[model samples]
Target: MVNENLATQVSRILSKHRLKINDRTLKRFLTALESINDVLTPELIEILVLDNLTIGESYFFRDRKVYNFLRKILPSKSDWTVLSIGCSRGEEVYSFSMVAKEVGANFEITGLDVSPQRIEEAKVGCYKFWSVRFLDENELESFFNKVGDKFCVKSDYRTNVTFTAGNFLSTSFDKKFDIIFARRVLLYVENEGLAIKKMYDLLQDEGLLVLGLGEYFPQVLEIFEPIAECPCVYRKIQRKEIATTAYKNVSEIRKTADFTAKPRAENANVKDESKKLKAQKEVITKTLERELNLEPALRVVEHCLENKKLIEAENFLRKLVHNFPTHYLVWKYLGILEMEKGNVRIAKEYLKKAAFLNHLDDEIWQLLRLTKGNG
Candidate 1:
């Protein structure tokens, strides 16, 4: 029989890592944890539990579009400082190094993740073929040397990119980044508003905050302004500017507001100003809900990703792509999945379809870069 007390303790620990497990999953999870290390030291328990529970998926050159866009907008002559939050195994940081070199821009990139094992792997700078499948043949030849079955990163790429392991919420940085890549991270955070505010504080003035496609929260508007041309890009602005934008948004809502409130029966022609105003408010609320309502299918995919359930995640994305036909984001994520799986040919086909449907997504554009060359 499973000890209820032990099970509760495990649940509390995983909760700190932003996981909420049901009683059944908890039982199965504890079984596996015990099988790995029955001694169950506090540190070991935390690590084992989180390793199985946290949200993490990564690859070299995973999102090609984001880098391509950065290359164009960032000053090539400046010394660029970039940060990748929740950088699992450091593919994102390494990708930026390659981008800087290709763009002929001097740069420093820091990758931060909470898993110590991931940090250790990143420090080793060696990866299985699966982790770097997105890099074309030329990139693979240029950046890595095969040892047995794994590839080790060359010295040039490893020199400036540093990996740190810690809770990002409690960590401190000495300097702000010119750009921060926060893709696919917020969905796993318990207090997303606080996490986002911290990201804003970590940016240089007017620095860019890149989020996952279709990821937005009301709190984001309080600290940043969306770049109109980029689907997931937001730029930090002064508080005054945020206030002005908020005011304009309210005014625009009012202008578009309409009502069917019953007026005085004797003077039905005259509108009840208060009821009309309430109706306008209702309309605004409904519109906001419609806009932020993430597709249920996509949420399922995120949940699968969080748990490292690749098959489920892939299946969900494939189904969404089939059902919606032109749902570009699903196509984009599906392509990312294939790239991670080392299927470059199929990945390119899916990514190209995504780009054709939604050209502005920086995520899709970046991955397309690899298909051009095998070496």
Candidate 2:
């Protein structure tokens, strides 16, 4: 029963936070909003709606490969500044603190999320069983102290971590960070391009931008390049070098131009040229189709995986591999799928192929080692 007025209000509220949801979900939320007490103020309604919509699903060390890579590359001598965008309940920021301590690196990490309740919970530094489910006995004992039935973060780990509840797109920072961990965050943003540009601006020259696995966007390449060892990690391009590179590219293009070439012979040669153009057009069309299909196909595979439809996910992944043989993601997911199915040896092979495609992909290497251990 959502009318135009309610829809407009919902749109305005979501825009204030730069968030987006499918139309069905929006309508559901509006319907729920209508049933609420009429005595509530507009501000209270906004807060309640946003809190319900906020996604705070996270656990400690959710992606081990990402943290392991961070530990491997972080220099001990430098004082690092890290930012965790969409850091649900602060696990990620604290994980970085633990890594910094292990590597003897001086660091300060900031965790930013849009949910005030989440921020308050994060500041408390207490977690329930589900949040710490992945931690081993040693890690749990070292990082947390059991209080009653809950585990609380040790003071040592909490010293340099700060949590703030603010929308990333609207919040301003006085300083740029050396690393920004924004995994799975941009997917929720309505204006993803603008969000990316904001991250680019807030990142120092050569700063790291860490994303969730399989999260790819074409616009990111304009300002960042994927690190050799981590396909999900990108390094910001230096501003001055961009100008120089553009000038060099323009010069090279001018030098390579052959605009002064004489006209070709007629008839057969013209037909031959037309045939060549048609062949080239076919190639371009195929390539374009693959490019367009890649994201949707991956989403379907992810949906299958989430639903534990391993066989179906594998079928789609196999097709993706056949179509995009050189794509590292195809091989990576194939390896992951095989591992999920308990085919350790087959997983190893797929991971090895992925490593060959992106030799520096740390996650691939990590998965390969994991396969070896499981085998």
TM-score of each: 0.65, 0.66
- CA displacement after TM-score superposition, residue 56 of candidate 1 (Å): 2.4
The sequence of per-residue lDDT tens digits that candidate 2 reaches over residues 1-375 is 565666676688888888988877777777887776475566776776667776677778766667888888887348888999999799888888988888888998999988888899999989886577556567888989888768899999998899999999999999999999998888888898998889999998889899875576656755676665556677898888556443122223344333336243433343443454344335434544544455558668878888889999989998888888877668888888988888889888889888886654456777888977654
> Clashing residue pairs, candidate 2?
229-360
**What lDDT is obtained when candidate 1 is compared to the true structure?**
0.71
Error of 2 at 21 (Å): 1.7
Model 2 regions more than 4 Å off: 3-5, 37-39, 246-375
Candidate 1 stretches greater than 4 Å from native: 15-28, 34-37, 247-375
Estimate the TM-score for candidate 1.
Answer: 0.65
lDDT of 1 at 31: 74
Each model's lDDT comes to: 0.71, 0.77
What does candidate 1's lDDT look like per residue over 218-293, in tens digits? 5665576666555457788866754543322333334433433433341232223334434444544454444333
> Which candidate wins on TM-score?
2
